[model samples]
Target: MTLETDDRAEAQPTARPSRLARVRAGLPRTGLAALCGALLALSFPSFGIWPLSIVAVTGLALLTYRRTLKQAAWTGIVFGGVFMFWLLIWIDVIGYDAWVLLALAEAAFVMLMAMGQAAVSRLPAWPLWTACLWVTQEWARDRVPLGGLPWGRLAFANTSSPFTPLAALGGAPLVTFAVALSGALLAAAILALRARGRRAGVACAAGAVALGVVGYAVPLPTGGDTAGGPASAEIALIQGNVPHAGMDFLGRPMQVLGNHVAATEALMAKVGEGKLPQPQLVIWPENSSDVDPYVTPEAYQLIDGAAKQAGVPILVGALVDGPDATHVMNEGIVWDPKTGPGAHYTKQHLVPFGEYVPFRSFLSQYISELKRVAVDFSPGDKTGVLQVGPAKIGDVICFEVAYDGIVRDAVTKGGRVIVIQTNNATYEHTDQPDQQFAMSRLRAVEHGRSVVIAATSGISAVIAPNGSVIERTQLATQAELEANVPLRDGLTLADRVGATPEWALALLGLAACGFAVWQRRRQPK
Candidate 1:
């Protein structure tokens, strides 16, 4: 080849644009994205400025509007990173390095969704499409790459907000869509006002108000209402203090088990003395017995003794000798006062890295913490619904409460009361337990079932079907709360249409993107 031709080829290669050049082009938008993320994170538990969720969405929509795909994607990454980092700061309790890795991985999904938002921003009624796009993104993130982490979801933040009633109509996805749509409309109104378009601004403002009306119009069966069906029986929730917080709780397995048994016995003493009313059933926190109660005679005898003394069915959380030798099962076993151990439900949605390391052979080479879970816990196939005394309880263990399907199954499959058995010993004093408690509250409202959360080191609570906490305990304290929790058999609209609303909304967003692409191509150059 001629020297001139070779020179031209080399120059042409540079003209194609280097990766650094492409990335640098989007750099200016990064600050806005990060700011949007910070606002979003602030909307969740602990900070819980509920309106901030809507504001964050508005910021994201405004930042991505009229931006190129590359710029939008960059904005999404920065936004997602900031939000996930803040939301999962509790993960640092495990290992800072692990927390950063997980946060980055989750941020990539948000980045993908942001690109779609940019694609349809030019369309008429773009805000509506963009809002649905947000729902689609959450739907994808919640179930991808080994069961997606549903933490930091917008719906989880709206537990106390006026928009929460939307959850009763169509579950978490609908609540998410409503919040996002309001934000998008508000953003659109602001943009129109900036352009001096009074008519357009007024229309967008009206649209935002309309969302509030619709949310309130939706018949949300909240508060102490008979809409939850009927009162089943009184239940007691025990929060037994652990020996110490963090992973050390596992090291003192006997103490953790002993603590729960002792707490139960103390409550019974109150009942016998007529200081407290008798509970039909008692619930214990997960990992309350790290020692396999079935295999260890000491653990079994201690549990049996507690059940007999309570004179009621006690749902005990225990680590059982697994479905196999290399794996353990985190299970909720029902101990009958007269018959001993009976019906059991093993946790279905095990935490990805915390419970079992994915790609363990490769990941363990770098992450030393992977070895901490020597034997992985296997997931159960069935939903956690069991009959105990006068109530049919739908039990979800630990992080399983964060998953929609896991929580939904219990309600739809004949569970009158929702019981969440969680061991927060590792996350004591961290916002992690508070964030989890928020999820339980939302679940209580979404399914129209009273939720009872029993935790180790602490934050145990009893929530009404309306998502109101009737009783609760403090962290690192041994406490017992007894309440006449109503058992509601009626399912909310969100329950009857399991996952359909999410799927339909997702399809609508995808269609809008397709149409936007077609419209863009047909435009004259």
Candidate 2:
């Protein structure tokens, strides 16, 4: 242990590192980590597919390939940062600068997962840390800031993947967990294949693949529409195709309402001429009449006239002020041919900055140039279930369908059918319609309820209870799509049990993670 001996030790590499370690050490560093985040965000779009995901997971694996907990955390933040930065692009244009808070919040949640993987690996048998962390992160994202934003959960990418059967088993959270687990397992196998215990790694990777295969193979609940009495109900969705500027409807309320009315009239004429079947319910997009129906007599008459002409129970989207004058309720009024404004379902879930500002007065300056839409609509109550004679129509106005719990609660409490009363005028040309359309599809599957999307601008659809897009309208089209949406009398296993499965899995994964952490701490150092 002389100074000369120590100098010699420092000069000579102790033992030339193995090839696998050499590969890890010799890997070049680049801003590829940031690119991984971008591609991962892009994966949220339709046809994003597995290739982008492989790039993301591989990049994530590289981020952790040879890093410590601190380094992993920094890299994970980089991963989350590029991700949220891209995810929030709509938020900035849609102007909830407050979304910066949500992005930061979610990035921190991802860091927790990074820490979980970094700290818990010293144990003999480790749980899928990446998978567990991913599920937990999704749950967290959808839980924070007024019950959470369930928008960018990983399972969203698997909407079209065969792994969708996992949704029926435990909703999208389970699917997300399986996908991430498989990807991480694959990455581990690649690393392990180049090392000593490659066989076990291959087996682990195989097990993950088996879970995915089994997910696809399993038969999900089909207690939906079948050979039942009066199984189908005809419904029509009117896509008004309003301008990208949200309040454009108010300027041309006549044209907006005229567009929908003209479309409905033509559709019903087709039904009369035996060209198309009659719809029991004719639906219009949110803000098809943003004129205050409750407070304005003239407005109610206008809507009532339209409903009478349509010859069906109509759902009219309108802006109405509350009784107290302190707030306004973004609402959809149920109007019958005989009675006008029969029953009303108000929007429960409020947009953080869009419909109503979080700190309304303070943040008005940022979005003032685009019309005062953020302050126009009022927050609706959850108990607002539309009473359509013997049938119950569960309605979610604007962005409420984006929330799993909101839609679930509606169906659980007595809503047999779900309607998305959305005004997509704020996001006309972007990928918002497709993203929102995918969300409705996932909800249809998760809740065992049919969904009718009445988008103001375009991409309105009729989605069955099992996530199938039964029919949909083309983008930026002024038209109505009529479909016999099979009415589901029963709820899904997920609707009945709520997030019970997710919570149980989370606890189990967390316990395994905690145990792994404990064993790691106690290991001989």
Q: Tell me, by TM-score, which candidate is best.
A: 1
What are the clashing pairs of model 1? none
lDDT of 2: 0.69
In candidate 2, stretches whose alpha carbon ends up further than 4 angstroms from where it belongs are: 1-30, 95-102, 124-127, 220-229, 244-250, 253-255, 364-378, 383-385, 509-525
Q: Each model's TM-score, in the order given?
A: 0.93, 0.87
Off by over 4 Å in 1: 1-28, 222-230
Candidate-wise lDDT, in order: 0.86, 0.69
How does model 1 score by TM-score? 0.93
